[model samples]
Target: MSLSELFISKELTIKDSLAKLDKTAKRILLVMEDEKLQGIITDGDIRRWILNNGDLNERVELAMNRSPISVYEKDVKKAKEILNTNMIEAIPVLNENNNVVDIIFWNENFNRKLNYYKKLENPVVIMAGGKGTRLEPYTKILPKPLIPIGDTPIVERIINKFNEYGCNNYYMTVNYKKNMIKAYFDEKEKPYQVNFVEEKTPLGTAGSLYLLKGIIKETFFVSNCDILIEGNYSGMLKYHKANNNKITLISSLKHYTIPYGVIEIDKNSIVKGMMEKPEYDYLVNTGMYILEPECLHDIPANTFYHMTELIQHYIDKGEKVGVYPVRENSWLDMGQFKEMENMIERLGVSNE
Candidate 1:
């Protein structure tokens, strides 16, 4: 695709820039005015802006890279050098008048995948306590986690993903149909250790985590049994440790296009502007997180508290809570029947 299609106006809101980024999947956009390059905005810039409490409705120029690296047409070779030297993905190509002419994308063949040979010793806590009300009849017979995605159960698939990353220890929080979940694993000779934390009643998502307070004395992962995250687990762990974040939430970019014209109004009831079928982009929580041991102290004991409330508590305390963004396709939600079918098809799992 041409770089011109990736140009977004500097006056556009940060929200608008995010939509542009998601639509293009280029990870960066050139901010232009009168066909002249003003600056550039990237996915990382937007993520940092959100982390620092920047308003979404603010102009994109507020968060754009004003002194971005660019190359002239004659310096095309220099583009590769800059990209390699700075370890950047793309660079803008500028004309004699400083107008953005094109964008030089790094060759995908040069991309190197990091080797995760080292095993991660951190414990992973899977919340399998919830009643699968959404997927009834089937869930009436089997617990949500025990539902088959292919030949393997959903929870086992979740465990296998972590196992691939060398996380051998698992703690499962179970309530409804807990016996079946335990029995299934008990019959098998598993490679990793599984410890069950039986909830007397249906404690909410974060409530069950409190049971592991004394047990987990380090940073660990918390995931919902019904969701699967397809991304770099090690990268997320590195980010959580590097930033010293008390909690790191894995978020997915979700795009919603409004099918009708939308109106904006002022306090005086004046029409500010009108947008036609505008698209909105959001970073939605994918029911996964990395948490420090200290975070467990905040969860009220034996109460129905959600992870969202726990996050808010930390936020209200002015604590550092980080968010790691991934592409929309990377998150697979299997809680509902439709999403489960989609995942089954994607994985080429035979329904028969």
Candidate 2:
């Protein structure tokens, strides 16, 4: 990839810069102004800003390193030493005019898969027992977990991503067409262990989790089968533990725009103001969570309970419940037909 692709303007929003990073599959970005390096931003910088609860709309400069490490010449030996010493991913090679001519990556092979993120060994639970009524016709034929996004099923893709983080142990709660879900995985020779938990009936999100109370004895991740969150899972865990949180939910910034002009009235029935197509932004839950083992007790046995109720339980008790936000594009949902199409497109899966 060209080094120019990682260039961003200082005024660019941290939210957009994150999206850019995901698109490029790279962590570092060069803040360029008139082809001159203004600053540098990395995934670590963004994580710090997020952990600080900084505004997503804030500019990159708010979280960037103004004085980034660079070299006057593209001397491989010197650049390698700097990268190793600093434990950084990439370094910028500057010309005499202080313009970035090339970028030297810690992984010399640009095409090689780079994993700057730590590999997590936490257990992951996939909520795959839902009837998947939203997916209708496809759900009629196969379980949502077994539904193919390309050649592989949605659940497998979720497992694959988690496997990359060294999380091999998995527990899947299953009810509707449980046999199909089991058969599909049974046929494959996967390296990870996927233990299936049978649910007698359709249990609400957190209800089935009660079955895993004794089985799971540590911090674990629970995710919906249809949504894939491509973020730093390892960092999320660290944030959860460091904050001493009981439960931490992964959220995304969702922006909504009203197509019509929005009108606002005061309490006195007076016309306060009008906004032409007002826009609203919110941190929306992405249906992924990291929870301490004890939090499982909040879910009563064999009862219909949603994750929201469990979250509220912690809030009601004044226990620490936190949220980690990712960009909107980073959370891919395929539960519905429209979102399934969007997910497929985003992953570049073949429609055929």
Candidate 3:
């Protein structure tokens, strides 16, 4: 990772730190203030805070470790020993000024990958029934699920990600160009089991989930075919069960910057405040959810219903509907042409 990506401000929210971590794909961050090192935070620290039900909006300083391990730049050669002895993934490199000049990860030069969680047997339900109107010309020829990100289709990539956690069983809801979706998979041999749910009629998002009532008997995942989320699937499931939530939505932190100056008016037409190009952060739904089998019963068969309505149903009934936040860049959405390009770029797909 770049040296700049490893540094963050103490004022940043835990939610923003999560985004930075996701963007860098690094498990740790160095909190720097006034050209000085303050502390360090890691994915484990954030996960612990989440499990304890800490507020995500809390300042990251609250979750950071005040004391951190470091090595001087002159003794950079010793960083590897420090990493191995401490059983840590990374360490900061400090200069004579005691400022973090660089950071070192144990596997910086290695190509090997690691898995932090054990295998999960839960099934995943991919919402592939939509016509993908936003993709337009591309959707006119190929279904959204078949649209390629890299060399593989987007839907296949989604399955492969979950498959890393040993989630082999999947039920895909198919409607628009359903035969193509089936044909493509039929021609290929896969280790995992793929079951297709034929939607005879258009059932908006959650409506088709009703078809899986009997088939899905445990906690399962629901993902939109056009979106990809790079997160810890096992962690999400753990949080869901820990909170006893009926459903847990995978949310992302999104920042929107206003281009023009904004003026605030009071009831008496007095200007309360004004700011130029202010940016606001919000948690956005990433089109992913973990749901208990019982939650499927709310959807009426053959009716067009959206997932938002189903979530609201549980909320109104006082059911435990929770949210698990991922990093902003972690959620790659291909719902639009622009985002599709971004997804392709992020996934390192060939435009040709």
Candidate 1 Cα errors over 4 Å, as ranges = 1-117, 266-272
Location of the lowest summed lDDT over 10 successive residues in candidate 1: 108-117
Which ranges of candidate 2 are over 4 A from the true structure?
13-25, 43-58, 69-89, 95-98, 104-118
Shift in Å, residue 118, candidate 1: 2.6
The collision pairs in model 2 are: none
lDDT of each: 0.86, 0.86, 0.87
How far residue 7's Cα lies from its native spot in candidate 1, in Å, is 18
Per-residue lDDT for 223 in model 3?
Answer: 97
Per-residue lDDT of candidate 3, residues 146-185 (tens digit): 9988789999999999987788999999999999999999
For candidate 3, the C-alpha RMSD (Å) to the true structure equals 4.6
TM-score of each candidate?
A: 0.71, 0.88, 0.81
Q: Compared to the true structure, candidate 3 yields what TM-score?
A: 0.81
- Candidate 2 local accuracy as lDDT? 0.86
lDDT of 1 at 219: 93
| Preferred candidate (TM-score higher): 1 or 2 | 2
State model 3's lDDT.
Answer: 0.87
Tell me the tens digit of each residue's lDDT in model 1 across 1-352.
Answer: 8768898898999887877776787778998888888888986687678777688789999999998988998888787678767756678888788777788776443453222335588999999999999999889999999999989999999999888778899999999999999999999898999999999988898999888888899999999999988766776888789899999999987878899999999999999999999977688999999999999899889999899999999999999999998767668888888999988987779667
- The local lDDT score (0 to 100) that residue 301 gets in candidate 3 is 81
How far in Å is the alpha carbon of 182 misplaced in model 1? 0.3
Where model 3 places Cα greater than 4 Å from the true spot, the runs are 1-23, 32-38, 43-60, 67-117
